[model samples]
Target chain A: MAVTARSRRVKPAGGFELAAWYFMRISGLFLVFLALGHLCIMHLIHNVESINYNFVSDRWTNPQTGYIWRLWDLTMVNLAILHGFNGLRQILEEWINRAKSRVVLRTGIWIFAGALLLLGNYAILMFVKDADYLKNRRDASSDAVTVRADVDRGASSRHPAAVPAFDVLK
Target chain B: MSVYRRGLVSRLVEGLRYGGGAGQWSWLLHRITGLGILLYLVVHIWDTFLVIFSPASYDAIMGFYGGKIHGVEYPLLRWAFRLGELGLFASVVFHAVNGLRVILFDLSPIRAVGAQKELFWAVVALFFFIMIPVTFIVIHALVAEPTPVAAAIVFPRNFVQAFVH
Candidate 1:
């Protein structure tokens, strides 16, 4: 007896699913570099203990290379967020069978992702170094001993007990 | 005709028991890690946003992440969060490597079908190769110095105070 063969015709890829599929691969390619580089810088080159308001301000507000850092961050925020939520959308599509629920959830994901994207972009674009904070640094720079004392005094006075734990750990 | 629906837990259990080879396991882990990272991404954006919203508040929150609140230290919580970051790092490394395998398979399904197992192993190898040294550095950083916390502060005692004051 001979067995019957399954259908061999290929379905042409198009529509939202196709676009989404392409988007994942492309965005993922960029993220492999963008994200891994970011992790390397944050986790490997410099540990989290070193990161603080000053570190961020210096990186984002430096006259020489601030724009490069900002653009790097902006690209990372957009690609990573979009890529992540799109993956979520795919997962939801797989699990949720109800049409109405799927619609609501999809809309909710987009709205939520959109809001985060907006906030991230705004933060990157609008960030300005605090002048008062900078002035404190500038004044303290004249003397190394005074710098440490002044910063400790200033930080504690401005924001009581808000000093980072690294001081104690040190 | 009658239709029967199975619960999510049962389906997951069944999937776990069924032998679908490395491909299936990789697919499952991809989804798991992808979801985990997505969850992190949401909070990360918000935390970074706080930098502009209030700089002092941001620093205070960062202090809390470093496991100090009101000048008090929690070593246990700090270590726990650091380990969690390690896990996050592992997940990201795995997800990224496995994602490349997926892209490879997609690029040439006919050729890749035979190499799926090899591709999976390659992904695993790459993940470890990248993670081993990085893991050492991370752990060394944690032990040698009191590394600042990069993870979330679930209880925002200082976070709230930064806003109030």
Candidate 2:
């Protein structure tokens, strides 16, 4: 590949894009095993039919587990997301030659990445919070079967995000 | 003209041979895997966000793909899913391992093709060193069961936690 004028004009030397290239490799290397393990367990061993809210819930809530799933997913989602957006940014730069178009595309990418980051974090953290709700309810309602039952019902609610919303929305 | 230094067909064959060296291979794998992950990430982001609207809505999507709604685990679909899983596994591994090598080679003083070639081989060596056992664990979990095998190996979360704290 010769340093064609078009290529030379576009190449930004030694900065964020360069750093992002480095980050993609580092993050990708980590994602290899993490993603592979996730795929094996979720897709291979159990099969898709077996995956449900309950399945996801158990991984987050089981006595055998801890905050492991929550944090692993958090790291996985964020890293995958950041790496992906950076990679796309490069493609966008190449494809969208016009400076104005590049800016618009970059802004769109940022907005998209931000929305994903927000929602992904919310879903993962909501599960974590739900786990905490179960833990506390178990600890506090040891003697109260009725209370345990109620908490269980509430925790398992269609949108247990309702503890706040159920109060406000209702 | 420079881009097609060789004819298209010859260039394709040369690419298949990895004629440029490890650097070229890294570049190739990164683009392929990056696109692969990007596609999946788009769907994932959409699905994860669906939860905000309603868990039922999220379940509706999962139900279609995985058959989690009626507990109808379709056997035939399993093979398709398995193929996808393996593809994703390969993409993630290649992209990641090659990515680390890219970072290291770029950061180092050596920008020569010779260094890039050598660094590429080193990265491949490191990738295999880690991936062989990981491959076993993945296979075992796929074949037998995952709970004991996958988590029992490196258990990366705990390992990383210990490293961090």
Candidate 3:
């Protein structure tokens, strides 16, 4: 921790890193409950074996439940990217203490975090609709059967798991 | 060193940094915890997505999780997984409460620098306050559940049963 002639003293440019630090403590607390609650619901209770496309469709199609999923998705995006970007901010704070570099780095973090948030939100919104397709267990089961048959044929022919040229999508 | 010594603000900032003041350590801890939590989130999401592909597959994947905590079947991995969850929980708790503190700092309706002192203790207080209960619940849930519980608690069992059946 000593400053030598070769090592210059680098000070954090502003209070943002401090803010991020405090933010971590706060977010960390909330995340414990959120994540635990999430785990209990998704993994610990009835087990994933019970979940299917119909399971998801039923959940999302419910007006109240859909809002809950939407909220969870938003919280995930907000906390995750912000937390990540803040970590990067600390790195920049440590190594890139100069004002000009700080500006550029902060800008980059913002843009990256913003993009991730947008993508996560889009996925959640699309999921509401996609849940419909997954609801049809019969169709999904047929697809699974077809895929399995293809795999069996490939196994007999000594073909790799890769799909045949004819099966390739455009 | 000379530059910092020449100005009050510079020296104060340097003191805060090297002195390991509340703000300084909070900043460092924030970075550490944030990265930790972010890593957890990635895996958590991937695991959850499996439920969408197929329930059977999802069960097959998760079947290995949450058994007797001290067996040769990747007991170390299991312990590590629990520890990682705890670590992420700690990180999340600290970050969120501290983030609110930061927000208040920005608002600065009152004395700004004075509030920084309280913010530090608040982080510590918040950590211990939340940790005790979370640790209790997590331990009880993990150990007591001789059988696997549901993947999600969002839907009660009765509701799920009614819907799925």
Q: Give me the runs in candidate 2 sitting further than 4 Å from their true place.
A: A4-50, A61-68, A128-170, B1-19, B50-53, B56-69, B109-165
Tens-digit lDDT string for candidate 3 (A130-157): 4444446445555663322112212322
Query: Over the full model, what C-alpha lDDT does candidate 3 score relative to the true structure?
Result: 0.54
What's chain A's TM-score in each predicted model? 0.73, 0.67, 0.60
- lDDT scores for all predictions? 0.72, 0.59, 0.54
The sequence of per-residue lDDT tens digits that candidate 2 reaches over residues A1-170 is 33442353232467876577557667777776676666655643344333544445656655545377767788888988887888888765654678899889989999989888888888777753244544653575566543211232124332132122112111
Error of 3 at A133 (Å): 13
Best by DockQ: 1
As a TM-score, model 3 comes out at: 0.54
Report the error of model 1 at residue A103, Å.
1.6
Q: How well is candidate 3 docked (DockQ)?
A: 0.10
C-alpha RMSD of candidate 2: 10.5
Instruction: Output the lDDT of residue A67, model 3.
Output: 70
Against the true two-chain complex, what DockQ does each candidate achieve? Answer: 0.30, 0.18, 0.10
Candidate numbers, best DockQ first, in rank order: 1, 2, 3
Candidates sorted by TM-score, best first? 1, 2, 3
